[model samples]
Target: MTAIYSIFGRISETIEKLAAIHRLLPWILAFALLLPLPQILSALFNDYYIYLANKICIFILLSVGLNIVKGFCGQVTVGHVGLYAIGAVSSALISLHFGWSFWLAFPIGILAAGLAGIVVGLPSVRLEGAYLALATLGLGESVRIMIAVTPLFGSSTGLLSIPAPTIGSFTFDSYTNYYYLVLAAAMIGIYLSFSILRSATGRAFMAVREDTVAAAVHGVNVTKYKLLAFVISALYAGAAGGLFAHMPPGYIHHNNFTIIEMVTLLLMIVLGGIGHIWGGIIGAIIVTIIYDQTLEFYFYQPLLFGLTMVLIVIFMPRGIGGMIDRYLATKKFIASQEEKSNAAS
Candidate 1:
């Protein structure tokens, strides 16, 4: 019995170590690819691989954006899909109607999403907990209905024939080009978000999240920061929306903004760990890959998703990112203790 327990403990330690490596691996590879490594690899691979790479990059962007609001800002929003829809439609309308290029449409669409976020978020200053969630719940349905009614938004049929993004003279018609485009945008967003969080504004936002009243007493300007958080998050969703609409398929529908879509985004944020940027990214990737692959294999993907979600929430409330952070902190503490003891000797 003792031997069996020891073996199990060893296996668990080994698995945890591997998981840590896996989490850090993506960032390392991303950095490496930005160096001479990508050139070496591209020398061997073809364009098809780039296509799938583009998909993953786009998902990473979407997750990272959603994380800005839900994870970092501590916003319990369930209407992210609606924000995404607003962004997608906004850009689609401009590009479709006026032939506005990516340079113009992308920023415009993001601003539109921000405006929508403010429109919805500005009214929710007093509502917290379930009330905020409930109010945002109405937003998704309301926008969904509006899209259903207006022929300009494609009525119930939704928008079709959305144009691909073109930057200057270059048309983003190929997956490889679009992949680089999306990757660049995602990298910009990730850098800006991390940079913002390290700034006074980000600190104020975090303070507001922890305790609004306490933040106010500290002169953090809670209302201003909170609105900033919402707008930043909406900007992310809007950019992602434009990417989704401009991708290979080059079409979108209101069904893409369904309630489940919003729920899934929130689930990714919660399951990965709230108030953590990387958490949202991992959660999004995990959920997207699992649900996408599972649906391909069978139709009962929801059952598996629900089960996974429940198990994660029940057993690891802080989520995968939280667990990783704890582990890292512990490791560093132990190393510091070891150094201190060695110095004393």
Candidate 2:
């Protein structure tokens, strides 16, 4: 703890200085989020594509959520799909069985999922890296089995006929309306993530991620903050699952937890950048687009994912995000050198 505190104590002034300048950037991000894609949503049948687009937005939100725990906090949680399932089941059961409205249930579902994350976080907090990963994988599997074995969850039959979110009388029935709702949700997730990374907690997460022992010495409550990250990640996941449950053109069969799916999410974060949100964004888009476009050509889907992951890892230790950071570092270094030369001359 002293080490982290000492390092931060030394650099605290600089960090605060940077934060002052960077805080307003969130508004710019808000604007950027609102800007519509000019070329893509142009077709009359683009509604179908918009449907695809909404799915991407959902995945992006999920990826961002996963990034908080797995990427930034240096924790490995393979139980995210379990979190998803929890949220969906919470909301769906309330709506389908109890006759509660979707509106009342959505937020409740998110809270329930948050509680689940905290529960999952408790045991995992004592663990780190591979051990923790395996624990979460086990948890996910357990959750899957519980859902499949229980009649309430419809076992293998699975739950169907979800209600949709609405504002008063206007049903979010159209693809465009649904797109906006999911997009707004996705944007909110991105914004929160950005804010988090810039804040003091984020720096602590990075410190722990880089070296837990060292980070602890610097006064980071490693356990607490790691738990916080897990909760934040799961919060996003729950919101996504809730939205997925309520939104139309809905999922017929909920995805069961698999080692492969967990590995795929890890691949997404690793390929994007461990702590970088943009990495998840990029990874999710690439993975989802390929998966959607190539399902008919089933032979190459897994092969392409494998090839993409292997090639990126070989060439890039930091993945795509790492390379971008390196480039920025190099550019700054060269610029500083040029300035020094200019001053000397």
Which candidate number maximizes lDDT?
2
Whole-model alpha-carbon lDDT for candidate 2: 0.76
Residues 89-137, candidate 2: write the lDDT tens digits.
7887888888888778888888988998887787666887788877877
After TM-score superposition, the amount by which residue 6's alpha carbon in candidate 1 deviates from its true location, in angstroms, is 21
Predicted candidate 1 versus true structure: per-residue lDDT over 147-184, tens digit per residue: 77888977777777777777668887877667767777
Q: lDDT of all the models against the reference?
A: 0.73, 0.76
Error of 1 at 284 (Å): 2.0
At residue 202, what lDDT does model 1 achieve? 80
Q: Model 1 reaches what TM-score against the true structure?
A: 0.85
Clashes of each: 1, 11
lDDT (Cα, 0-100) at 36 in candidate 1: 42
